[model samples]
Target: MKKLINDVEKVVLDSLTGVQAAHPELRVDLENRIVFRGGTPRQGKVGVISGGGSGHEPLHGGYVGTGMLDAAIAGEVFTSPTPDQILEATRGVDAGAGVLHIVKNYTGDVMNFEMAAELAAVETGVRVEAVIVDDDVAVQDSLYTAGRRGVGLTVLLEKIVGAAAEEGLDLDAVTALAKEVNARGRSMGMALTSCTVPAAGQPTFELGEDEMELGIGIHGEPGRKRVPLASAAAVAKDLVEPILADLDFTSGPAIVMVNGMGGTPQLELYILYSEVAKLLKDAGVTVARNLVGNYITSLEMAGASVTILRADEEMLRLWDAPVNTPGLRWGA
Candidate 1:
């Protein structure tokens, strides 16, 4: 594949070296494949940690900072981090209060994080709780997960729950907030093109020029179905309808995100966002806060995903809280 890297095996390590150099605010543990916020384990704050494969940039790693994740472990591309690596991250960030692991609803991620929590509890005596995000309404099952994949809501969860952790909520309270967020959010994604994994040196999947994959997962796996490509408005409808139908978003203010899947340009994403916003407005859903950009991505995949969270006053307040991270930063 035509990717910029020294070698296939060194991609994660080399990219992490660049992360360490680019952002001094983050402490990078290259050997262990963990990224930590500088000056971690903030006395009594609940530490937040999330991890996954390496191709999805500005995800677990880009989110390590003052108001989001305190630490993130990196796996190989689209692979789950080992239990030992996760245990290291949990132990490193435990501040006596406890640590919260925000795991996406992928089989590998869920199992690995669960094992890590057990190991950390036994070996380090550090309290650990986990919040599994299964916000994608794309499918009831997928190759990588038993239920819906976590998808875009994981981003919203990290920001909102991270604020709670930063505000010194105990581990239990933070975990509760995370669960609440997951219950209130839903997501759907579509893909126009496939992504190429550097190690494999080929696109993960193939799509005809006139075709699109609806209900796509982030790993470049096959989506729910393939359909003829359509207008942005039609695509937006396909995304929003399932979300609104699955959850009653009109009853409250909503936080909406129109996320690009790695390769889609901001201009295209904004156009798609405009369409999504219009649909939400017509459906009587108030958009309290909106994010339009690439947050969670599949490696150079061309597509977009929409995430909607039914926000109560507390969730809205948390959304407005100050956050400082490489991926998302505002009011910090």
Candidate 2:
């Protein structure tokens, strides 16, 4: 209710305008809401395309730059882009090398992206492959619902896979790298409170002043449970334990990211990271590379998400590649 904006319906349009204007190296397709890599799609190199909702700023669009995504499609706030939009972007970015769609594991997102791929196969010879990230350990792979929500690990996937694409790896190679990251990564999120979607115009869920929701989804889906607020160390344990249990991060070195859920501050993120470091050390996992910030988030949801990636030599090499984007920059 307190959000600063003209209209809830125009949030995506308004935000994209500013992003395109600020970054001259990027080209925006307003009608389609796809962000291209500021030039014609290069031939003989694999095209990387990613997208989801709008509130996760500097995500799909922000990462569309050199050594990153070739194009990014934007959906309505917390909603999936239409299949037609995704198909257009897929066709638009095709340069004979094929295109990869990096999609999160949300219901609408998965369904829409799948439909788009089907359309692409029927209409064009542009080969499309997707690597679905279900790294969030929050949701159990149950028989009823979508298994898990892709969360913070998605940010890492984009960087490493993008680097592989920049290295001129074939579509299969890049997708393999993307899958490797997804398989090795595990994430868990905790929410201090729920966020209100502009369209809904109300809080998605409620948490008491002294309670927090654990295992929350980015769009404010109810988490596994809400518990009384606990100490930073206790909360960090809540976030990290599920991830550690979900993956074998202890057997080798790992890359760790402590991500804020939009409303949390850097200071709190670091405080949580401190406890995460201690816990990982105790678990016999080595933190090789670490990022502590808001890489992925729910809108103004006060909390954090922890992601751990088991690293290998090849992944480490790609992780070091230069990347220029609004959210992350490295090696340059």
Question: What shift in Å separates residue 298 of candidate 1 from its native position after superposition?
Answer: 0.3
State every prediction's TM-score relative to the real structure: 0.99, 0.97
lDDT of 1 by residue, 222-327 (tens): 7878999999999999999999999976488999999999999999999999999999999999999999999999989999999999989999999899999999
How far is 309's C-alpha from truth in model 1 (Å)? Answer: 0.5
Runs in model 2 deviating more than 4 A are: 141-145
Number of colliding residue pairs in model 2: 0
TM-score: which candidate is best?
A: 1
Candidate 2 lDDT (Cα, whole model)?
0.87
Residue pairs in collision within model 1:
none
Counting clashing residue pairs in each candidate, in order, gives 0, 0
Tell me the tens digit of each residue's lDDT in model 2 across 185-296. 9888889988888999998888889999888878777777889999999998898888887787547778899998789999999999999999999999998899998788
* Top of the candidates by lDDT: 1
